[model samples]
Each structure stands twice: as C-alpha cells, then as structure tokens.
Target: MSGTRRLFAELAILGGLILVLAALGPFGSYATPLGPRLLHWALYLVTGYAFFRPVIAAGSALARQMGMSRLVAIAVACVLGAFPTNVIFVFAAAGPAWRSVTASDLAGAYLQTLIVGATVTIVQLLAERGAVPASPAPPTPALPDPQPAAAADATEQEVAPALLDQLPPHLRGPILCLENEDHYVRVHTLHGSALVLIRMRDAVAQLEGQGERVHRSWWVARRAVAGAVRQDRNWKLRLIDGREVPVARASVADLRVLGWLGDAPPAA
Candidate 1:
C-alpha cells in the first residue's frame, strides 16, 4: 500500500484501541488483583506498540544497509527502542492518575520493556532473514586507455548533435542531471526537474541501455559528450556550449563502453 494509506490505517487502529482502553473500568478495581495488574500491562503494551513500530523499522533498514543480518539488526533496533517505548507509556499513563511514579518502578519498567522489545525484534529479523537471499558483491568493469587529444576533440563535436537529437524535444535544452542523495536520480529539464523516485541501481540499469553514466551523478547520451579535459587524476566530460561533468570512478567503464573518451572533432 501507499505510505499515506498505510499511515492512515495505523492511525485508525490506534484510535480504536485508545477508545476501547479508555472505556475500561476504574483503576482501583484493576489495581488490586493480579488480573487487574495484567490488564494494565496489556494496556501499556498496546499503547507503546504504536510509538516504537517506526523506530524499529528504521533501525532494521539501517542495519540492512550496513550489511548486518536482518535478524541481528531488527533485534538490536527493537531492543534499543523498547526502553523509550515503555517510558512513553509511563508518562502517558501518569497524567490521568497524578500518582508520583517512583524511580525504581520506572527503571524496572524500562528494563522489562527493553527485553521484550529486543526479543520481538530478533524474532522478526530472523523471520525476514530466512525469506531473503544472500547479497552478492557488485561486479567491476575494466578501464580503457586514454584517448589522444586531437582525436578526442573531434569525437566530442560529433557526439553533441547526435545525442541532442535522440532526446525528446522537450528535454533537449538546459538539462540538469543530478544524483538524488545516492538513492535515485533527478532529471532536470529546461522547465524543472522532478525526483524520479527510482532506485539508483534501477536508474543505472535503464540508462546503461540508453546512454552511459559518465559521472557518479551524471549519465550522458552516447552522442551528447562534446569533449573531455583531464585535470590531475580527475577527468571532466565537456558537453555542448562548454557544460562540464565530473567523471565518477564507478562510471568510467560505462563511459568507455559508450566511446565517450574516444577521439572526435571539436564543435564548429
């Protein structure tokens, strides 16, 4: 489901749970016997669940990115989140009763909550780990020999108009290609650029079929690169009208494959 729909659904569920809990009888009845205490615990659990769910999810995602096993990450995140979760429960419940909560009670509750949250997180992570395959290392490509100066200039001139022709008419001018925080790509056209909301890996795949990634943040039409300049160890691709792009180490192979570094004529 869309994030908005999922958020609304969670909110609806929380509202329902709150209404049900609030309708339950006086605290004095529930406080006396073990059964009443258990009910209060249940209430605390339900109330705390909503607040910690997102925290756990975020932790899991971070762990996954760091190459930790799903199980381990989730467990760590959930466990860490539990203390705060239960504390929230205490603060939330305290207002209605005006009872002074003792330090020891809060500390014990925090520890208990941490244990429970950690246990739940570990179990969930394990379940998730079992469902996914092991990740593979990304493949590396071989680099090409540098192009000779005279020939490279000629190649640049030849590439520009050809690349421009291939682009949709509307995107032919003032295009700004930027990396979206390493996650996705933003294609800026003459008017404006919108976040494409696509994974960088997927964007690379698609662009590889159409052009070449000349820089970490830039993809160029096989025909769009007007020329290139080497300054120290870095190289920059020159586009029509003196536009320049920095070549990323990761993109060098693809740039070579598209013959972007090959010798070409200068634009007249």
Candidate 2:
C-alpha cells in the first residue's frame, strides 16, 4: 500500500479500537455521566492521535540514535510521552477538576495513560511486524541466442555474493545498514531496503568481512559510515547515504577496536 493510504487505514483501525475499548469503561472510575464519559473518551482519542504521532516519530529517531529496536523505541516513547499528553487532557477536559486534583492524582492519571499507551503500542507493533514483503518481479524472456561462456564468466566474477545477495536484485547496492523488524531482517542499501526471512546472525555471516553489528538489532557497513555524532550520552554513526545507525554502549569499544571510532572518542 502507499504510505499515505496505509497511514489513514492505521488511523481508522486505531480509532475504531479505541471507541470499542472505551465502551468497556476503561475510565469508568472517573465519576462522569454517560454523555460526559463518551465525550471524554472521544477527546482522549483525538489527543492520542495528535500527540502520539509526533512522539512516535521522535521516539523512532531517538531509538535509532540509541541503538534500540523499533518495538523498544515505541514502548519507551509512549510511556514517556504520556506525561505531556495527560497535562493537555487535563487542560482541555478536566479544567476545574484538574485544579483540585492532588499530586498523587496527577501521578495516577499519568500511570493510567501509560498503560493505555503500551496497549496501543503493542497493537501497532503487531500490525507492522506482521506485514509481508512484496513478491519479486518475474524474469524477462531470454534472448534467442545464448550468452557466450566468456561473457557469463565475467558477469559471475563481477558480482560477488554479499549480505545483499539475499535481497531482491532491485534492492542490491552499497550496504547502508540492517534493521531487525520482529522475525525478519530489513537489508538497507544505497538504493532502498528489502525484507528477508533470515536471522541476524546468518545475515551478518553472509556479509563476510564487509559490515559489523552495531547493536543487538542493527548492523552497518564500515564503508557506508561517513561520520559519527554524539547525541547527549549516546553515539550514532552517520552513513554515506544519510541514514544514521545507533552505536550501543557495549559496542563502543568494538567500534574503536575496529577503527570505526578513534581511540579517544569525545566522552558522551
């Protein structure tokens, strides 16, 4: 599906789920009338869609910088993002009720939002991870005359097998990085990315000496690394193609040992 259409579909599904779930009275203890309760939940959904989208984007970027997985990033982002969203909800809906609420009540409200955030994150994660890769294109018809043995030999010698060999031919290019999405691995290249059903270890093995795993769920090509940047206390490798790969804390020494990082990296 197109990115735009997919986004709309996801929003529709999320809205439907929230409405149905709200009917079950997840916020039953709030002590509001039926009309007020319905409006409250409806407003909650609006705030959810508005706030969570940017939070998710920022979280994904932060996760990439922190050498974290997509799932981990979403979970962390939602939990942390609840604090701000809850404040917005109080201002928009509770008003005077919010003013009277104690510190403990505010904390409790954030905790509730955190639970809802986690639930929503899990649903979105499942939808993304369960998606299938597109099928490969059919081969073109062969020419009437067969290729000469010399020509075939030269073609074979020119294209050496690398980790990208597992990807579709269209996606083959200079390796940028690899991302683990649930059970599948996304092989990213200068051209684009493609998903393959392979374990991270096996995929890395196929790369031979070409690339190194920067995190448990991320691998990057040494040649593709253009520079390194430190974000607060974390490190990220900027690729030649403009993509960034996070460097795990445990792997800092490894990068230095591998010459990807100098002996004296600026303290993060």
lDDT of each: 0.51, 0.66
lDDT of 2 at 7: 71
Q: List the residue pairs that clash in candidate 2.
A: none
Give the range of the ten consecutive residues with the poorest summed lDDT in model 1.
134-143
Quote the positional error of residue 137 for candidate 1 in Å: 23
Q: Put down candidate 1 lDDT per residue, 1-268, tens digits, no spaces.
A: 3446545555565555444444553334343455655556556646555545665567646543453443466556676677668777776667766368777767867865675455444433334334321112122111123355345434533544443343444344333243433333555432333444466556556444335655445665443456677778666777543457678666666666656665662222
> Please, what is the TM-score per model?
0.35, 0.68
- The clash count for each model shown is 11, 0
lDDT of 2 by residue, 129-174 (tens): 5554533333322212336545633432344355556666665655
Query: Which residue runs does candidate 1 get wrong by more than 4 Å?
Result: 1-35, 93-99, 119-268
